[model samples]
Target: MSYKIIVDGIQHKFSSAHFIVGHDKCGRLHGHNFHVAVEFGGPLDPRYNFVVDFIDVKNAIKAEVDKLDHRILIPTASKDLVLKESKDNLDFTFSGKRYSVPRDDVCLLPLPAVTSELLAKHFHDVLSQRFKGFKIKVRIGETSSTFAEYGE
Candidate 1:
């Protein structure tokens, strides 16, 4: 039989800023109180009788989200963005507008856009690698009511 362990709470959230490349209002720099939840699915280990320990999953999730907390999320793979890196700042231009943010306050993500949908997928890919024997699902909320999910 298959079982799933789900984790989500106040500790699983981060606040970050990002802008969509071609979006109208979203293209303007803004931030969100983003929340993340994860589900791990697989047969329970005979020894533990649980899919995995809650602390293990919690710690992994916290580590990932903590890196993004209170930072600007920059997408490195977007074809519409031009980036210039300096020792102190990341200068990026999108849709004819230029912005320079401090390197220390930014998290560079290997994604085309820093949307909730892609963020969920990025979490799924990373967490799945950490827990190989399970099917992973990631759900990310950009706001209290708006959410996006990824994984099988």
Candidate 2:
């Protein structure tokens, strides 16, 4: 039989800013204190009696969170958006609006939008690749009551 290990709480979170292109209101940049929950499913090891070590799972999730914390997430694949990078800054033009920031302050994702659904899928893909032999589910909280989940 297979077992599941889940992780969630205040520590499994990050704060970041993003905007959904083409959305009427969400197209405007905003920030969220986003939370993440990860579920790992597989047969438990007979010797360890656990699906996986909790500390290892937590560290893996935290590593992804650390990359997004306190940064502005940009969708690198958006056709409506243009990004120009210089030695120290990144310039963005979206829907006729322009924004510039230090290159170090942005996280460019290979996605078309920076919505919670896509973020969940992104994390799911990242974790699934890093940790094999288990089914992975990633839930991204856009707010305390709202979230998106992806699994594979």
Candidate 3:
């Protein structure tokens, strides 16, 4: 039988700023206290009697969140946005507007957009890479009422 483990806690959270390149309203740069929940599903290991250890899962999720904390997120694949990098800073131009930030404070993601849907998929991909042979689900958002989920 297949078993599943879910990890969602205060520790699986990150705060970051981002903007949609062509959005009408949300195009303006904004930040969110984003939370993540991960579900791992697979057949239980006969020796361990569990699909995976909860602490190990939590640590993996925390490590991913740590990379986005307190940073400005940019979609590296956004067609409407352009990114220029320097040794000390990163420059972004989106929808005819320009912004710049220190290289140390940015998280340039290989995503097409910075919306919650893509963010969920990005997290899913990250976790999938770290933990192989297990079905995974990643949900991310600013609040309980509004979120996006991705799974495989």
Candidate 4:
């Protein structure tokens, strides 16, 4: 039989700043109190009788989201952004504007954009690596009403 377990709540959330490229309203720097929810699916282990340990899943998701908490997310793979890195700071130009932020306050991501859809996929990829052999679904919410989901 197939089994599924979901993990979500106030703890699985992060607040970060990002901007969407080429858009009107979202093109400017904005922040979100982003929330994450994950679903794990597969046959239960014969010995444990559970899909996986709840503590393990929570810690893994928490670790990933904590990296972005209270930081500015920078997408390194964007062709429209010009990034210059220094020992203590990061300077980037996007949408004809320039910004210099402290290095400690930035979370560099290997993504083309920092949209909710890509963010969900990014979490899904990390969870997939940590929890192999199980189907994984990652859902990200920029707000209580808006969300994006990604998985196999």
Comparing 3 and 4 on TM-score, the stronger one: 4
lDDT of 3 by residue, 13-91 (tens): 8999988888888899999999998899999988999999888888888888999999999999988888999999999
Arrange candidates, best TM-score first. 4, 1, 2, 3
User: Across residues 33-95, which tens digit of lDDT does each residue of candidate 4 receive?
Assistant: 999999999999889999999999999999999999999999999999999999999999988
How badly does each model clash, as a count of residue pairs? 0, 0, 0, 0
Greater lDDT among 2 and 3 belongs to 2
The 10-residue segment of model 2 with minimum total lDDT is 1-10
lDDT of 4: 0.94
Off by over 4 Å in 2: none
The digit string of per-residue lDDT tens for model 2 on 1-152 reads 78899898568888999998778898898999999998999998889999999998899889999999999999998889999999999999988889999999999999988989999999999888888899999999989999899996
Report model 2's TM-score to 2 decimal places: 0.96
> Which one wins on lDDT?
4
Error of 1 at 12 (Å): 0.5
Q: How displaced is residue 7 in candidate 1, in Å?
A: 0.3
Which stretches in model 1 have alpha-carbon errors above 4 Å? Answer: none
lDDT of 3: 0.89
lDDT of each: 0.92, 0.91, 0.89, 0.94
- Per-residue lDDT tens digits for candidate 1, residues 50-145, read 998889899888999989999999999999999999999999999999999899999999999999999999999989888898888999998888
Looking at model 3, the pairs that clash are none
